[model samples]
Target: MKLTELADLYRRMLLIRRAEERLQKLFADGQVPGFLHLSIGQEAVPVGVSSALSDRDTVSSNHRGHGHTLAKGVDLTGFFAEILGKATGLCKGRGGSMHVADLSKGMLGANGIVGAGLPITTGSALAHKMQRQGHVAAVYFGDGALAEGVLHECLNIAKLWSLPILFVCENNGWSEFSPTDRQLATNLEKLGKAFAMKYRSVDGNVIADVAAAAGKLVGPMRRYPAPAILECRTTRVRGHYEGDRQDYRDAGEIAALEARDPIRLAAEALAEAGAAPDLIAGIAAEVDAEIEAAAEAALAAPLPKSADILADVYTPAEV
Candidate 1:
């Protein structure tokens, strides 16, 4: 737990927090189009996992993927622009909130379908396996996505081929409108055993725990391409999104999770390790400014033109 590493983690997590907060505001103000899924409380999983990977490694993220994208070094301006559906976006405004992607940064995209990123990551892992490259593929999804049939199929293929893949399950305990208890028959870790792959379960609320666990898995995957699963038990600070009323949750359950907010936990750990209080404040201020600038820029930016509706969907013949 070096002071510098802890500080950097804190800074990254804060950026996710502030950026999503700004997105929430913009979503409500009608600036951002399409459905939005926020990675508000589960910042540690993405940041921690990404910390262990090289830039060449890739991640396939779920709808709640802003944290994962940012952790993988996606440009904040470009991401915000994509959410705003601006031409300056990574997808050139063709893919909106649910489809923001930057292959250069190794983020596949935030897929709209439940558990769709699993197979995508498995394919990426297979590509790396064929090249015999040291790069690893990580896919982040919620507990909700576990219900998808493709996830199990992908898991089987990755393990069978011993592909370098990390399947991260951000088990926040809800599948959108359905609760995990109702939808899932067994635990996620148990499913890993059926696939005969390496598996780990961690308290995703603590970034340190997540970092340590993630570090342990990264090395093995590179050495011997095998499928691995890390089940992070975390929570969502906001409703599924800004507008979700969260009618399914009890007041007490939300309160309990909020009381154990991971951002606060990380800040406290850093402060105890001799990080200056003002340094933490400075980081917070910096993130706030960056997010605000992105929001303003996105709002003033041009939207995709009606003429370009199907341009990116299929490449036109080179004439």
Candidate 2:
């Protein structure tokens, strides 16, 4: 990867890492409302895939989607505010974290339901193809969604019509509280082949590797307009939700995953690529300051008014 690109990736990955860390603290202190599903150790998937997409390209995200939304260019303040349920949030505090959406940024909102993004992404891809727009739609989901019926149906239809969509499965080994292997026996690559779609898998902790793999698939997806799947083997450092005690995970699992932190790996790659140590430190410092400022602003923002609960829910037709 180019130095500039590597720096950009590192910056984004660090932003995600720091932001989630802050959110964890905030949630612990009773600041954020509702359940929080963090993509703490899965930053590389969104950073890499989004880097390969254009501003016009669209993406759909699942419950653990703060990273995806941020990587797609949602403003930091709005994202934090949304999570904090402030009126100044992306959905005016109505959607909170799971439903955060900014259509202007081509983020089609994060779904709360498993496997929900598949059809939404497929529809967006169909729209792009029908409109002759040289854009693609990428969807982020977990390995658990592989069992959802919608996933296979969407894949079959996407292949039949050659939709310009990328199915990104962030397989973190665990589905909710259970290991994925215990719930499903199918190989993702072989499943992709069943539908005759392009498929690839990579180490989700390595940003450069993920980016390289995403670029190769997403590049041709726009020109030829076909469905593809990129299975990223990742790790989730936190519990399923913020407060759940992780008795299901083996004793050393979390520590072992932390040892391969994506942010640290990216920094090492940057240094190896001739990036100065000061430059790397500066990046982390900048991201930290940014997250802190956003968090402060979000905490101080006003709550949504009770009267406006139904304001943006529907639109009236022109008279």
Candidate 3:
């Protein structure tokens, strides 16, 4: 990647970090309405993967998907408003933190259920295949979703049909409060082979590694289309959700997580890759100001009115 591209990735990674950090404070102050699952330490996976995608391509994001949504070109102003439950939000405040989406940007939606995106993206990829649209579908899920039946089902279908889809596993190794390794019988590498799909695992903290892996798999789908799995070995620093004390984790282990922070790693990478210190510092300042202003606007935005509560409902209220 060129210096400009690398810098932009740095900016985006910083944006996700700052945005989530702001939400952390908001949720703590009782300003946010719903339970928040933050992807604080997993910015590189989304930033690197989303960079390899086009606007017309679709993304089906999992529950912990703020980074996914933002990296996929969702505006910060509307994103903050959506999480703040404002009427002007992308989903008109209906989706909130967990279900936030902007279909205009080809973000299918951020699902609340684990592994829900798997089938959604699979069907989307099938549509692209049948229609010959030459667009690839990307689904973002955590290692926790490995146990879900839908993961296998989707992979089988995708393989059978040669669907143009990318199964992105952000393996933080945790399923809510428990470790996923203890819960799952098989891992992603074996699962990839079981499904007869191409697979690559990379250090998820390094943005270049993720960008390269995703670029190879997702970008080529338009022509030499096929199903592939990219496992990002990332980390999750926060609790499963906001407000949990994480007493389950030892102090020493929790302290170690700070060292693995993606934001810091990305900055270091950029500097090592010949980016000047001023450029990197400027990017941070720019992202920080942007997040602060957007958060203020989202907070000041109007909440959903009680009278218009069911405006965008698909199913009948009687049901």
Which predicted model would earn the best TM-score? 2
Q: How close is candidate 3 to the true structure, as a TM-score?
A: 0.97
lDDT rank order: 2, 3, 1
Worst 10 residues of 2 by lDDT: 309-318
On lDDT, the stronger of 1 and 2 is: 2
Count the clashes in each prediction. 1, 0, 0
Question: Which has the higher TM-score value, candidate number 2 or candidate number 3?
Answer: 2
Q: If scored against the real structure, what TM-score would every candidate get?
A: 0.97, 0.98, 0.97
- Model 3 agreement with the true structure over 1-319: per-residue lDDT tens digits: 7889989998999999999999999998999998899999899999999998888889999889999999999989999999989998998888899998888888999999999999999998988888887888999999999999999999999999899999999999789999887898889999999988999999898898999999988877888679999999999999999987888777787788788888898888888889999999899899999999999999999988999876767765684
Residues 1-319, candidate 2: write the lDDT tens digits.
8998999999999999999999999999999999999999999999999999977899999999999999998999999999999999999999998999999999999999999999999999999999887899999999999989999999999999999999999999888999989888796888998999899999999999999999999998878999899999999998889997999888798889878889889988999999999999999899999999999999999999999866866796779
Q: What are the RMSDs of all candidates, in order?
A: 1.3, 0.9, 2.4
Clashes of 3: 0
**Candidate 3: stretches off by over 4 Å:** 315-319
| Residue 195 displacement in candidate 3 (angstroms) | 1.1
